[model samples]
Target: MSTTALIYEGDWVSGTSQLDEKFIGYVESMNRSGGLKVRVTQCDREDAVGTSVEAALAKVRKLPDYTPSAPEELKDLIELSLATHDKEWFDELSARLAAPQAAAEQDEEKRYRFTPYQSRLYRIAE
Candidate 1:
């Protein structure tokens, strides 16, 4: 069976509430910062296991604002959480997140150096 893994970082809450001011703000921030990378693996199965990552995301979106962070259409998220705790899977996910930082450093090191303007009076003798 093919299985798709969608990886994202956040404490998924069941429902929206203002009672816990701190948690509400945190979750809202996560919702706004949508940089989470979802790596979907195509699984060969019929149930939720076979559902595409896109489908899983859609399900999450449909959840009511009051749903708790535990279940509430979080089957896919739960799977991701479990996978993240697995040594092998967590290592892979960590690598994926680190790639961009490494790439940025490499790009900085290879950046172009600006040359002085080729003005007639300021031209350097060859």
Candidate 2:
């Protein structure tokens, strides 16, 4: 058995209308798939300012013996979301994800940055 975890921010809406409806549908489909678990935590205005995807990833990396379990497909979805909704942030995230983790971690004091919409998704297979 193995489990994979994905933590990132989400943008449910751009204004009054819903955004990422297709992505939402995909998540619903995953829920119906039985082995997937999704957890979404909405950040308050203040919290959102202080939190970021990089910070989230950095925190996850700092966990004792922690490793990301998200499949390449899921990661691609995230990349797509960033590319569509937040190009600047996506550019930063893409560079970070592509960078070697070992090199990034060497600067232990580096701050993890992310957008306002933070989310975490994971899957367990048995």
Candidate 3:
């Protein structure tokens, strides 16, 4: 069988691996706090970046009312918004969002990574 490649952080880690294999390898490289893995993977890429960001926001919204303590990258994203929009409003919203997200992370059940959906488009495009 021919192998399909999944690019991780624009680097080739495991070549010719199945989707699950590639995803497991990617998750292993992540830090447990702040959902940094999601932020980095979703926000960094050209192809899946926007979709990933949308997914992240949806995940965040689904969490219970808890606070996120260690959220440097998220803070930066909020700050970026403040730079463009209203600083005070964004700051308050950021704080509120941070708390629940932090609480959500404390749970053992939070699904962290983006699940890959298979498509024929990859083959068709090629």
Candidate 4:
């Protein structure tokens, strides 16, 4: 039976090979004949991260998309982005971490409904 392809370029994946250190990396390229090149990011074997490593499609499991909500988690991701020299990802994580504080300020504004007298006092002066 033919199976649907779930992995693609740039997807984070974990290795399923019988090695001492299981690698986690993003897919760099793929071949139609069940082969792929992964840019190893996190692994015990430090020497293998030089370029890209080859693996069978069946030997890699795609990692699920995740958005970390905790400040510590977001900071960790920001550090990782910096380590990888991914400016776009660094900006994204920084923005994501800052969004909550902005939203909290907006929520406070919404909560303090102004009276007619207070509204006039707070109105823009021409």
Leading candidate by lDDT: 4
Kindly list the per-residue Cα lDDT of model 3 for residues 65-101, writing each as its tens digit. 3344456756766777778887776777687767776
Model 2 RMSD vs true structure? 24.8
Ranking of predictions according to lDDT: 4, 3, 1, 2
- Give per-residue CA lDDT, model 2, range 1-126, as digits (tens): 111244212312111102111111011112222222112233233333222211112112111232343446446756786668977756665555666665657556455644455445556887
Model 3 alpha-carbon drift over 4 Å, by segment: 1-70, 86-96, 101-126
Cα RMSD (angstroms) for every candidate in the order listed: 17.0, 24.8, 25.6, 8.0
lDDT of each: 0.35, 0.33, 0.37, 0.81
Q: Please give the ranking of all candidate structures by TM-score, highest first, separated by commas.
A: 4, 1, 2, 3
Error of 3 at 40 (Å): 17
> Which ranges in model 2 have alpha carbons more than 4 Å from their true place?
1-74, 82-85, 101-126
- What TM-score against the true fold does each predicted structure earn? 0.27, 0.21, 0.20, 0.58
- In model 1, the worst 10-residue window by lDDT is 19-28
Choose the strongest candidate by TM-score: 4
TM-score of 1: 0.27
Q: Model 2: what TM-score?
A: 0.21
* Better model by lDDT: candidate 1 vs candidate 2: 1
lDDT of 2 at 1: 19
Looking at model 4, report the run of 10 residues with the lowest lDDT sum.
1-10
